[model samples]
Target: MKKLHHIYIISAFLLSSCSPKISSLITKDYQSLKYDEKVVVLGLNEQQPANAEVLGVVKVRDTGFSTKCNYEIALDKAKLEARKVGGNTIKITRHKKPDLWSTCHRLDATILKI
Candidate 1:
């Protein structure tokens, strides 16, 4: 019974390690931009460009099962969402680093068109 319990725990760990990250976006009508256009990333305290137009909000997070939830991966996911909504820049609003409960980076960002 003890060995069976260990096997179950190992199986659960393996399943979680293979899970994919999740992302969400909320936006209005905006023309999608070309992939060739570079998407700029802004820090939490960074000031947005004066001529920038707000496009939408983006969030990337670990679903408790996500494995490769690193900062770069999360940021890239947010940028992809921004590009889909015609945003040329992303302003990071909240960043949650890996903690005891989750071994993944999470972020909330505001998409903008400059």
Candidate 2:
């Protein structure tokens, strides 16, 4: 009985530890911009030095902009970049004005990692 109980507890702990957390954020935003905009560069860091990596890309809703692009970088990098730019803040910069079909908006953010 004790052995079975120990196995159950270990299994539960492993399951919880393996589960990945799903989080989302809007790295860039363009409000009422007629032309499309492009992001030139992005900087990311962490509050408490930690290694980070780019995960993937996240889709952002169109807010009357030309084109919108979002990226899923490492959480640690995101947090660091965020703190650098503006703690818990998102920064958006436009390189060129929108044309018609698409507007370019770049995402420059950082977040904490595990």
Candidate 3:
């Protein structure tokens, strides 16, 4: 019984630590830009799956656990910018709950201009 208790505690800690945190793009202000223009994002830590396709604009809401905020944009336009950038990583800013509640995930990406 004592060993089982220890296992449970360890598992709980691991699960809590692995939980995903809210993240947003930290670049040019997303609010001021036009919807049709592509924004550039930098310093993204994770690589988006190669197979993942931008499926139009999505407004994601935070569920407080294993979930995060969302945004909306033109799918084809976003993909075009992503391909032009030549890098899979996009910029994002992380947010926490209670102290950090917001209506939208502020994120945008832009292709480097040659």
Candidate 4:
């Protein structure tokens, strides 16, 4: 048990389990973007209203930090970039576990507009 506990603790520092890291944003291949519009952030369980069109997909890879707090920061960054592309809403598609030690949190969202 001691060895297991030590390993977990060590992982936190090495992987930044709960730390907030910089968000690596990906936004592209979007056509018909509406700029200067209000955007709504939605989680997986949340439902989006009617007549909304999907703008584009945005992926955020937040490293060093791997926690909800960090994801929120990354989400904020994603939203900011989405707005620039005229995204009025974002529907989070999926979240994945760390693919590697340095790359901690991975968030996938779909940008939408009405």
Give Cα distance to truth, residue 1, candidate 4, Å. 54
Provide C-alpha RMSD values for all models, in order: 5.7, 16.6, 13.7, 10.1
What tens-digit string does per-residue lDDT give for candidate 4 at 4-113?
99999898677665644433344453543454456688888988767877667777765454455446676775676677666767888887655656445567788777
**Candidate 1 residue spans exceeding 4 A from truth:** 1-25
Tens digits of per-residue lDDT for model 2 on 23-98? 3453443232222222223333323234433222322222442222323322333333343322333322212223
Q: Among all windows of ten consecutive residues in candidate 1, which has the lowest summed lDDT?
A: 18-27
Off by over 4 Å in 4: 1-38, 63-69, 97-103
**Model 2 poorest ten-residue lDDT run:** 32-41
What TM-score number comes out for model 3?
0.21
User: Which candidate leads in lDDT?
Assistant: 1
What do the candidate models score in CA lDDT, each in turn?
A: 0.83, 0.35, 0.37, 0.66
Q: Report the lDDT of model 4 for residue 61.
A: 68
Q: What is the lDDT ranking, best to worst?
A: 1, 4, 3, 2
Top-TM-score candidate index? 1
Residue 44 C-alpha lDDT in model 2:
37
